[model samples]
Target: MTAVLNAVPETSFAEYEALKAVLDTASRRMAITVVGEVNTQGRAFAVHVATLGTADPLAPAIGFFAGIHGLERIGTQLLLDYMRILLCRLEWDELLVEQLRSIRLVFMPIVNPGGMWSMRRSNPNGIDLMRNAPLSAEGQVPFLAGGQRIGPWLPWYRGRVGAPMELEAALLLRVVEEELIARPVSFALDCHSGYGFRDSIWFPYAKSTRHIAHLPEMYALKAMLDGAYPHHRYVFEPQSVQYLAHGDLWDYAYDRVRAPSVFLPLTLEMGSWLWIRKNPMQLLKREGMFNPIKAHRTERVLRRHTDLLDFLARAAYGAPRWLPQGTSRQHMMSRAIELWYRRRRA
Candidate 1:
């Protein structure tokens, strides 16, 4: 293990090492699985899924995913930080232990380890996993930024037309299906960075401007966040509000699971621009666009999202209490349309 950890050049596999450390010392409650493997540069890396809490299919589950984009190391780092905290808390935090017994927590903290190792957005094959799903946007999308079929030489390259989903993307779907979608109530929070001036929490329908079927539930979740943390700076909205994209894995997953269950998949796009704004010199570095370059700023970013993660866990644990229904659902749907979709049409 030590030799494997040291083999990677320039700490490229540091996140993997940290994940291994957590797995090495994880409590019996945590079950670790390697869902897939990627062999690159003569070194093989495993994509891990760590699951905790109840095994009952009816139990609500919340999944925390990060490191989809290889350049966004901060997301992986923040998640690792939170995982370490949770493992330590399991030792003595009685409330957390009790909460875990009723709710399931899933972590896939490094979804694209090869991409991170190569310091590129795409995996070893150069396919963008986020855009590798076999789905397309409903209408027009933003040029190359939306996903293209040109080739892997360019960024946002979706795999060949009618091609199978990338291994990493497929593994992610399998985990979500087996662990989350099978349940009646589940939430997925996929962490990301490198967009906008303020932190944003985005829901599905990246394929179109149309509101998802669960807009009311999404609105209630946003409202819960607002009521609970009024000072939060996150802009909760649909991914379409910013721009449309093709083959969004979350959109595909949400569509597949929406019929018989409630699955709310959220992408937390942390505002890396703010970090660059504070330290304009970060522009000179490729990673600076998607991560905080300084130690102090990185620590602050890690601390900032801890509350949001905790809230999601608690919200999932007590989803029945806050999930709106009937008249309340209708009212929230109306307000959500007004807040998210209606104005855009005008």
Candidate 2:
């Protein structure tokens, strides 16, 4: 499992601070802390959380909560990619600089360690961190809302039974309680993958299509993002909420913690599934052997996602506060060119 994540070292904890070695990220001005850890096959796995800038306990915060689904490697990659550049260039970017002066950012890249190494959709305990969230009903059993169509019976099923934040969720909440309380994130973007639909974005706990007071602002943010990402636009979809699924992370973000969080599950569902369908453990094989092309393409694709993610993180950092205009159209056009180059090779 550790070998699968070629970039991030395969590691297990012998002590609480074992992760500190890998946490090249900072503290104080920038924070990197271990929010949770889950045991798998007798090995301890830790969840590392980070922030781009100073954490103002009083000012509102914006955050990215991702990778609750362990198999969704892309989500964690995107988060880490965003953080890599954000940690450094933040001070230079006018918008992000202002955001740092005014507000804070919360980045929880890997919300489910147990599931990631195991290459399973759910945690070691078989709980989908995304669905394990507490429902609004408080103490009541989870149920469908609006027009949702997902449940435990599905592939990404929630646990047989447990409270919200039952395991990973609870650790995440504790992190929020201790660190985000001062800022209490006003906005959250949770990233995932597998659907591979035309880059879509869904808002709030449910997709009922009801007008959320913040939709305008949310759309505004999307529109600004669309400026550079014309080809990449929110699909206003998923039906994960209004369509089906009770214990989804989006709902938990809204109904449970009282934050406005949108779910952006980037489904780069390329044909890898086709090969994997023939052999479920196909990806588990050495990249150099099973599918060298995919392995190479995966690295390249993540580089692109990393670039966009950094742009988005910078944009989010500058929100409402005033961020400098993003890279010029020429830069984006060049990016398009790079995509074509890769596509041509593919």
lDDT of each candidate versus the true structure: 0.90, 0.52
Residues 1-346 of candidate 2: C-alpha lDDT, one tens digit per residue: 1342334544532111222432564454466776666888877876777765555565556567666766666566655656656656655777667657765667777777777666666777666665565442222233432212255445545555444455787776666555553343355666665433234456653433233334334444555667876765345432332244446555544444434432122222222343345455655663212221355555654565564555554554555453212454344435433432234446
lDDT of 1 by residue, 1-346 (tens): 2464576466357778878878887846589998989888888888999998888889999999998899898888888888888988988999999999899999999999999988899998999999988889998999998999999999999999998998889999999999999888999999999668999999999999888999999999999999999999999999999899999999999988856699999999999889988999988998888998887998999999999999999999999998888899999999999999989899
- Judged by whole-model lDDT over C-alpha atoms, candidate 2 comes out at 0.52
Estimate the TM-score of every prediction.
0.96, 0.66
In Å, residue 129's CA in model 2 sits off its true spot by 1.8
After TM-score superposition, the amount by which residue 58's alpha carbon in candidate 2 deviates from its true location, in angstroms, is 3.5
After superposition, the stretches of candidate 2 with alpha carbons farther than 4 Å from their true spots are 1-22, 25-29, 88-99, 136-154, 161-164, 176-185, 207-211, 233-242, 256-295, 311-318, 321-346
lDDT at 46, model 1? 89
State, as a TM-score between 0 and 1, how close model 1 is to the true structure.
Answer: 0.96
